[model samples]
Target: MSESVLKTLVIYTATLVIAVALASVLILIPAYVHYGEIHIPGSYNALYLSKYSPYKTIVVEIDYQPGMEPTPKTIEALQQQIEMYSGKEVLVYLDQDIEDDEVPAVIYGYDIIKITSMLQEQNRDYRTGWFGGNITLYILYLDTIWQQEDQDYSNRMHAASTKPYSVGVTYAADSIIIFKGSLPQNDMETTILLHELGHVWGFGHTNESSNIMNAEFEVYRNGPSPDDVVETWYPKDFSPAQKEELARLHETMHILALFN
Candidate 1:
């Protein structure tokens, strides 16, 4: 081959290699971010936090299968949690619009997202725009489990027993999925919901076992402290530090609203 042609070939090959690497990063970053494995700084601060959103109204619009719905107590608890996070008025609207028969026994994040497009449009109170309406946060309650694409959680040493430990997931900034079938009762149901809601508000996992944002529950739900428990974290609710931060924001939003 001619020296000039070989030089051009080398340049083209280098350019192609760089292009492939860039494309891989572009794709993998979002996939990891979507799966909650990658944390982006201040991902949803403007939408969920921030002292100056266009409005101070957040609507918790839930879509549930016929057999799986958040209990009244869970509803109240999550409402209070989100209210604290956004420092705004939160309205709860549950729609029993999903059919258990229609849900697949095993699904992934994208599977439910495909269905939410229609659900969001049909939600009577759905409003995610910035102006003239409340911000809508979407949640799905399903009787079946949602298996993550990369999470090999089918078998694990859960705090309770050897069972899958996935209870909830936040696949998008404004969407959460609750594995209603996996929740033994209202307590974990409430805990997992609040945990996912924390994710929506830009909270990342912390090592503090007592903090609500701790990611230990992702591996095992809370159980009585046994000396040999695999995962040691037992988060009852939001930690004091998180609460203080949220309280300051909540108070600021309240004070800001008064001036508006």
Candidate 2:
């Protein structure tokens, strides 16, 4: 072959190879996006009505074990409580139930939150930012009892002496466990739900005897006292002090984010 023709052929082949390589690199090139996240500590962030929070809409998820269903009155009262306290639109959803026999007979305090997280992954439908900027309040009603984790003798004695078989316990900022086994199947159900909800709203147990946020249930249980069966004398509601504290939330603007 002539040198000039051969050289021209070599040049064309090299050019074609270079063009193919360039095309492949362009095809494989990635488009990168850099962004930061917001994890509003799960506890009381649900109540703060602030624009900083990514969750503009609040969602409630209730999962029950068989025979542990919350009554209509109880659910209605819960809706009312959230609406009154958060001053935002509220949506409550009854979700998949853990089997009656599947719930652990007794849940220890330390593992309560772990179990709650597992159950949430299993049963929760609406998650943070699922329906646009949103947060979740998860409640599990199980036919089980709660025992404070007492690792040693002193702790056991203290827990035994101070805490009763929990009617309900707040395991996280937004998670509540309703010990259906502990409820008496009356107005107390609604009362206990509100009580646990108070903790989610960042209120501590109170000493006021007539208040729903009292640490102990004996004061309001169906005993011979007139206060028993919360519907009788006083209204089924938070104490004046709790209301006062919650009232301050309107101006308390601390906001955070959740997993998208």
Candidate 3:
């Protein structure tokens, strides 16, 4: 090829390459970064109601193993709680050996997952009362006698942690389990059950024993603290105003991002 023609061709090619590189860097890079920011979870700053409706409810069947039967009053208290959440049906399956004629409920054995799925479909929240589940809970029944280091107690804790139960909306877990060697005092039973359920609802322990989440109860099973009640009953759903507030929040965040 002629030298002049070859030199012209080289200059033209280099110009095209530079233009393409500049265009890509100036346009494509920013577009890609912006695209990525849009698709991230909780991005677009949107508000969403839970797929599960707050109104519907379900109750899991509770059964007591050989050593872990709960009391009639405790069972009744559990039922009252279930009712408080909703008028939806509460089912309790008791061991054939224990008879409580005063408490009006039927107990039967059935598939847990199937039941959970049904509850999910119904958009219901299931409450596990301290007394009912074949799944037994332990409490420091007699503080003087109930040893924390007991092998049996340790084994029970291990089993509860390992055993799979549908504990939350996203995953199933063996929730913190408790067992009482003997019946807890009236005040203690209610407080413990309330506190444990608090944990189930995503509340953590607090220094305040007056709080339901406090571990001061005689038998702290699936209980909630006052904090638990606040956490669990606090409307999880965002109202129209809340949605607006969330949008405002996102706007505020974007505005703040400008300074950063």
lDDT (tens digit, per residue) of candidate 3 on 38-119: 2222221211111122223333334333444556765676556544432345454444222233111211122323433333
Displacement of residue 212 (Cα, Å) in model 1 is 1.7
How high is the CA lDDT of each candidate model? 0.65, 0.63, 0.34
lDDT tens per residue, model 1, 116-199: 555555643574653446666778887765544534553323334344446788766677778787665455667788888877
Top of the candidates by TM-score: 2
Window of ten residues with lowest summed lDDT in model 3: 135-144
Candidate that scores best on lDDT = 1
Off by over 4 Å in 1: 1-42, 108-125, 150-163, 221-234, 248-260
Candidate 1: clashing pairs of residues: none
lDDT of 2 by residue, 90-176 (tens): 888885568655567767766676766777777767655422466667789887656665443234322333344567877665678
Q: Which is the better candidate, 2 or 3, if ranked by TM-score?
A: 2
Q: What is the lDDT of residue 23 in candidate 3?
A: 81
Q: For model 3, what is the error of residue 184's alpha carbon versus the real structure, in angstroms, after optimal superposition? A: 5.4
**TM-score of model number 1:** 0.65
Q: Tell me the alpha-carbon RMSD of every candidate.
A: 11.3, 12.2, 16.9
Q: TM-score for model 3?
A: 0.34
